[model samples]
Target: MFHIGYIRVPRSTWSVGRRFYSSEIQKKTIGFIGLGQMGYPMAQNLHKATKSTHRFIIYDNNAGATTKFTSSNSDTKAVSTPRDVAAESDIVFTMLPASAHVRAVYEGSDGVLEGVTPGVVCVDCSTIDVRTARDVAKNVEAKQAVMLDAPVSGGTPAAQNGTLTFMVGAPQSQFEGVKEFLQKMGKNVFYCGENGTGQAAKICNNMMLGICMVGASETFNLGLRLGLEPELLNKILNTSSGRSWSTDTYHLVPGLNPNVPASKDYEGGFGVSLMAKDLGLAVSAATEVKSSVMLGSAAEQMYKIIAGTEGYEKKDFSVVFRWLGGEKIGKGKGK
Candidate 1:
């Protein structure tokens, strides 16, 4: 059975396949695609946490990334295309960036679906739109393969440390099928219903993150203008009613949280362009449902402005702090 909105439809009503419980999953070859900033470290952690007997096949559009990763990880080999990765592996994982990339890797003549066998499982860990996630899942299901949308959180540091969190959207029967693989890649694995729910959860979470970060940055600037010391205001905010993950933990102000990207001239963290992209996803999803995300809409505009700033799109999103303060928030500028 499957869910369509508030209704439950029998499995026969859809063209989906039966769940294939394979004990060979433990020995199955694992294929990884998209080895960018987050994906590279994530694939590394998966290899490190797996058994020595395990085999891995990897692919990336960037030749440098493939060469760099394969040069160090002897147990893994770089492949020619997404099809090659899928052809050799029993289960595949993709951690791509955007919807277009995800679609290209899964739907073309040289795509993953073309190379997959029946009962194979394909897990996508990319942060993309819900419709794309669901559409991709349907395509995999049509081939008698299983698909799971399992986007992750915790960024590069957590990915490197093997402590990222995965929000999975899959049928109840499919949860156990992929739990071991997910556990190897992250500390937390949450089942967020089926099909596109994982992407839905990720979009909502990042939307709130964008809103809170902006609010925190603006409020901190306001406090500073009113004569409060950075440390003192941060201390008060941490204890006061305004405390949040943005204000108390990953504070946008530089000195307030030296561990965050803001403290380092916004060098290494989630980029402003990515945040703008996620915020755009939030607004689009809201519009589809006729739901009002007023703050999210405002946050999107703020990030769009920051993304337009010189060198700001690639910097940490906390660089919004620099923009908010009317400072030159780019390379070769004042601190």
Candidate 2:
């Protein structure tokens, strides 16, 4: 067994044609794939934090995003494929959108697995299903590399500010090995357990978030219809038992919080379709575990409606407030 920082990688798992040299392993290279809204800023913070000590490589499906990232960050190289990023880096971080995208980026032709060197560490920060995350980790292990599922919490604002919370799933030793690196882009790093548990935690958290948002929206809409002013109702909810991250931090009532998506017309935070997808994952996980999540199932359906409706699909998940009839209560109306 050889060590990559604190994590020991068994050489018996190495496949033919995979290189395992001390010099290559010592290169201190870092790679990031997927340059979406959250990934872009997370990568930026990581690059800024490690620019002086490590060589940074980035890849994205969008040429424009690649151009923008490379133009803004000096000494960063934009590669053409995930394979190339894997080939040139000792550690790779991916933050794709969903299960399929994560699979394609990691297991597809010219993907990360194609060029992954033995002892390399891969961190997937995508909030995909548990099965997929485990399957991908197994594949990485087959290649004699380490893989960690580390889905993050916090919205775009937290990502941009480098304050996101990462829920990581891996062995305790492996978690310790990667904690410092994760700290570069996030404020909190938690060890959720082996292989797929990080994804499990993320889906569960989002399930509650969806349910809370729906409940908050429904309550706020009722209060507005009952002639309660939004500001007064918001103040009550925030200080009372109704308070939650949905109500206190990202309240759906516009102008209540100037920094949230509600204030910006719900354009750029977590999209409705994404929340629907996460809720679906939660329902699936509940089914697999033979657990009951009636409220999660109900929230999943509500998000499906908002995601399927025209003009609301791409809006923030908090748009459920407007979809449920709270739009007329505030100064800003849903588009």
Candidate maximizing TM-score: 2
lDDT of 2 by residue, 286-324 (tens): 999999999999999999999999989899999999898
Q: What is the TM-score of each candidate against the true structure?
A: 0.88, 0.91
As for candidate 2, its clashing pairs are none
Clashing pairs in 1: none
Candidate 2, run of 10 with poorest lDDT: 15-24
Please list the C-alpha lDDT of all candidates, in the order they appear.
0.82, 0.88
How many residue-pair clashes does candidate 2 contain?
A: 0
Error of 2 at 163 (Å): 0.8
lDDT of 1 by residue, 164-250 (tens): 899999887878868878888889999999999999999999999999889888886676666666778788888889888877767
| Runs of candidate 2 exceeding 4 Å displacement | 1-27, 330-335
Cα lDDT, model 2, residue 192: 88
